[model samples]
Target: MPKMNIKKYTKNYFMPPKIDMSWAFKEYPDKAPVWCSVDLRDGNQALVIPMSLDEKIEFYKMLLKIGFKEIEVGFPAASETEYEFLRTLVERDLIPDDVTVQVLTQAREHIIKRTFEALDGVKNAIVHVYNSTSVAQREQVFKKSKDDIKKIAVNGAIMLKELTEKAGQKYRFEYSPESFTGTEIDYACEVCNDVLDIWQPTAERKAIINLPSTVQMSMAHVYATQIAYVSQHLKYRDNVVLSLHPHNDRGTGVADSEMGILAGADRIEGTLFGNGERTGNADIVTIAMNMAALGIDPQLDFSNMPEIINLYESVTRMHVYDRQPYSGSLVFAAFSGSHQDAIAKGMKWRAEKKPAHWTVPYLLIDPKDIGREYDGDVIRINSQSGKGGVGYIMEQKYGLDMPKKMREDFSYRIKDVSDHKHKELLPDEIYKIFHDVYVNVEKPLALIDFKLDKTADGMRNGTVHLYSGGKEKVLPAHGNGRLDAVSNALQKELGINYSNLIYSEHAMEIGSTSRAMAYIGITGKDGKTAWGAGMDTDIITASVKALISAVNRLQQ
Candidate 1:
């Protein structure tokens, strides 16, 4: 064999610029988006730490509070736990009158019977039936012919229609061609038409043919084309509600759902925060917020999103990633210098105008809409960050007039640390790091000694001494708990009378022995608020330091 020399070659890659969504906004300008939560079904099934019945109930209530008119509670026939949850919902009359709960089941006799048993005595329900219709699904999963799947779907639809008619229940029927996105268009239409023929939904009671991208296999445009094709071809299309349920395997779930709507889908099935199997389903929060950005009200009441997020985090035990779209902690956070500068300017622009126009320099949607406070801390610096972030923090927190040189120096320091840490700095932590690096000073309040004692009668007492402002103050107090006693003693020494000051402490570093950070929110006598923080190896000391910081702020 002759020896051949191979030369290395590199090719330049160029991608198209992202399209302006103004056209979409203009085309679908007026119609209010329909939202359906698949939390109890899709979200529950996806969670590694599944919700208990009580947790499910709590989550269901939170969904209602968030103003979802339609919710898929669960596949009642799938498990006794699910059936019991549905039964509990019915028994307690927990579902809101206007809201409709949906139950999913295969097109089978026994499952449908169990589904009905679960829906017994429930008010306002939708019986969602589905069967695998794609060639791949039928051949791979069921090992059946297309005709067999069609018969099964038609039989299921007829059974549901008969059951609803005989029982005189106010229920709607919905059918999904499972894996419809991958199915042959003709076969999908055939199966959907067969089910529609059996149910024979009238114009007044239109059946919903929910086309789901069970596994997101292509781009959003492809899904839109599929949806449009189905909408155009389905028999008795006028008497049907075209619905879309898309998953997030490709990370295009939101775009796919929206494009499906544009392609004529009348309903959307998604989970809050896009919780589902694999990469999760479309996030209803992001979708609704997107609608709001288009000047269309999604008609959802997300006024208490923080509390809702807290509840969701607690029940699902799923941490909302800081970068997750709208609801994430860092969604509104700006770390880049240019971004922070633009946002700061935009905020000021909106503030100066009466009846401010929401369209501003950098904000896509107003933070206040989702009950988020506009704080500088959301913008921070790191290696990939810039000067705008540092300047914004300085002006907002310390009211410092940072010169350009100071900003450049700060930016360099931030970059140095960020490069070393290999991550962006949080706003609070950035300030702390900056203080430690540059503005090194003696401790403002030094904790000299503290002692906690509990009597045999279970009474708790503590004493705390601290040196601050050139004076050593000692105070003693009793409380129901050691931490409470310490807090009371500190309060007395500082003459700080705050109402309902709550202290939450959490470990910031890794491992059980790592130091912890304490966050303290104090409601002042004037009913306004301020937050203080401390860090220490001991949790109690950290909390005490945080409380002292709060008191010091009050004194200032």
Candidate 2:
């Protein structure tokens, strides 16, 4: 083994917040923050294959359908295709009156003018301008001081204001201290206040002062503290919408956005599934769903989540991980034996008790609320399964009612094959296994013929014929019940002995014309148990066939 030096990296905390941030702990967002999706802009730019103009239009329609009143479309001046896309929206009058389109640009002169040109006839628009003010950018990238960076932001805000006045339009403005998390707190506040002075925001024309964790350099709590300091010190607090745009460098974009919201930030800007540059932006789906779970209306409609995921993946040329929160294929799936058992019991309890709230043990929210079913999605059967989950699936899928002990016995058979194959068994495969192994089977001891006659004491006398050793034999017997009477005839005729019969039955279909299924378990003289199932149009026949199947299994 070779030893290598590991002290090549160290912590660098460039920004220090001025406030103590005790108020962040005392308040949590009771309502959903104002949401702005930057999917078509920030998210699309990061894709290896960016969306075409037509695809961007399709995605924009989807966002509108999902109840987004404010959608940041794209940067018009960045590319000719982007410029055409915005022109198409305006020229064709595709934007709705309720929705406002926003476009992003830097603090440069020509870029800011061309960005407004794309929103020529828009009903409502936001001209979003940003500048890099972090210590690293000032030192290395731009080689400028704090005063020069402040000039960029102030001049951009003035240009936005002048353009709106010259065009005789009422377009809102947004300013971002691009790397807000890395910029010194007092300097960042001073620049934002200067922009606020230039824009002169009011209750009717609110300016968005977006604070972005562009490179997420610290913990979520630290970001929240920084947001709290800015929230307290910013000028014209009532007229400014403090927005948070968090990237996932530390894998805590969601945490930073949530904590920022708790610290008095009023808006959230991100992509649908956190699709953006580097580690990507905060996932708006997760943040919104979190709000919904907390009894707050997320304002956005995610009811048909599968449709949203399909469209997002199709347009973005990206694949959503199977384990992604709330929208993944396996988000609601429970694979562990203990988790499945608890969920099964909880479902039964909710059905019978009819509780007011969703209280499934392993589930945080009712999956059906998002269009997922419990049968296939919940209670997955594999090597790590138990009787409760198997029994639940059997009952839900095929309407089979197995006794508790028999269910336990059948679970082992299912797990045996699944473990041998090293895979999870689907519902149809499990059903076929049950049918082939236990259903009314006739083998070495096939039923030949039987005759029954009623007696005076409610007992039935029976005569049964069977071929045991390639020869036919006749025997007569009597017992208290029909099954018992048949059992007596089989024992007497075939010299087979068994006792302690347990039986259950249920209607496989709904009406009187429906077929019935019966399950039976019996113990033989060797102290071993056998199980069976049978289906017939008549209940009595089903029971008789079930007993015959159990006897054959015992013999084998």
Candidate 3:
């Protein structure tokens, strides 16, 4: 391994002079910016195996369905597949009337001509031309002076105007100073202004000046300041769409995009999930969903997020990381005991109060809003789960609202099973554990039959047939109610005594059969409580069986 040397690296970015920091005072943008998806170009090119023409078409269709008004299909002049994809869209008339397709080309004349040819039959298109403008490119690669670089950009802009006039097509133009972050901020703006001077963009047909962090070289704030300087100094500002195309080399691509938008950039050019060269471009999904979280309509529809994820994964052969924000599989899952407990309580509050806005703890947005289920996505059960989470599963999935003390006891049993297995327990497995271990336990003490009748004084009279200790004994008892009457009979007949009997019952609505569910908790002589549950078609039978189950547990 080579020894790391910090002395060899110096900051390559230049801060714009007298940058207006006023843009930082506001919170996030109140409105959605113009979103331009560069997935088919930037994201696809970064893939190990680029998408085939058919896959590109499918991906483009999904982008359209997501409400993207501008989509950079590909760099047509760069490859045959890229050229054919654009031609196919034109021939099939797949481009919607409101959508404008964009193509990328170098400042070279041949590439620019081929790029325009690819968009020959398109109704609306953006001819995007870029030239490397960074100080590193000037000194190390091209060895060109400032004037020479400016001329190259100027000539490219003039050629685009000439071709549009010759073909009688009103194509909007866009110019990118590639690696703008590493370029002198003033020099980069000067080159862009020269290009705009030739295009003479009008309000009706506005041009785009995309400032890409082609290679991220500074903090997001520095990039925002650079964008602010360019936005202020640009010629024909009203007729230009100041755009951002930030890469994620420092993992701040989304931050740069956000701050740049706040700094006056009006459009964003990014790939889905931030897929691109090097680290990747800004993630459009994250940025747009961030707006949605802030109560701003992002103009894109991601309601069916799972379907979008499936298609993105299948087409790109890239897995969305399980921890990816908003769209990943586990982003909404709560497995920690504390997280699950809070989430469960928050859900209960939401149900009871029915709040107009989302305020669930630990959940930024409702999972149901993105086509995820509460039982499946949130409140996942594992050994780390606690009483509130386990209780929630029982109530939500099975309609068995166990008492609070019983819930704690049941949670221990579940945690033990999961800890031993070293795996997550599904809802059905959780219910199975509850049923097998705690429900209707028949053992040394069993209920053969029982009957209860009301007395003339409004007290309950009861008779229970018991089979215990290898003998069957018939006993009669009376108390305030049928359950109390049964409890008195059990203590007298079986020679067992306990106090503070806690019980609850509800209709089991989640199962196939119409059954009543009952839970019973009894405080033993030691003052510790044992819990058991029972289910039956009749409510009285369910409660009686529950008492017997609790007694069996307590005796054990």
Between candidates 1 and 2, the lDDT winner: 2
lDDT of 3 by residue, 1-556 (tens): 9889989999999999897788899988979999999999999989999999899999999999999999999999998999999999999999999999999988777887888889988999998988989989999999999898899899988988897798899999999999899999999999999999999989999999999999999999999999999999999999999999999999999999999999999999998888999999999999999999999999999989999999999999999999988989899988888898899999999999999999999999998887888998898888999998899988898888888888889899999999999999999999998998889988777888888899899999978987887688788978899889999998986688898889899888787457998999998999988887878888888898999999999999
Report the lDDT tens digits of candidate 2 across residue range 1-556. 9777679755544545567667666645779998999999999999999999899999999999989988998999998999999999998888999999999988777887888788888989988999999988999999999999899889888988987799888999999999887888888989999999999999999999999989998999888888888899999999999999999999999999999998889999999989999999999999999888878898998988889989999999998889888888888887777788798889989999999887789788888887788898888899988888898888877778789999999999999999999999998899999999998777766656666788998988977665555677666868897778878887876788998999998888433438999998899999989998778887878888888889889999
Which number leads on lDDT? Answer: 3
Candidate 1: clashing pairs of residues: none
Candidate ranking (lDDT, best to worst): 3, 2, 1
Q: Residue pairs in steric clash, candidate 3?
A: none
lDDT of each: 0.77, 0.87, 0.91
Task: Write down the TM-score for model 3.
Answer: 0.97
lDDT of 1 by residue, 408-500 (tens): 666777889889989877667777765453331225656676787898889788677778677887778687876678677766766668866
Q: What is the lDDT of residue 200 in candidate 1?
A: 78
Q: Please give the ranking of all candidate structures by TM-score, highest first, separated by commas.
A: 3, 2, 1
Which ranges in model 2 have alpha carbons more than 4 Å from their true place?
A: 1-6, 14-22, 448-450, 465-475, 509-513
Best by the TM-score measure: 3
Q: Which ten residues in a row have the lowest lDDT in candidate 2?
A: 9-18
Which candidate, 2 or 3, would have the higher TM-score against the true structure?
A: 3
Report lDDT (Cα) of residue 118, candidate 3. 90
- Candidate with better lDDT, 2 vs 3: 3
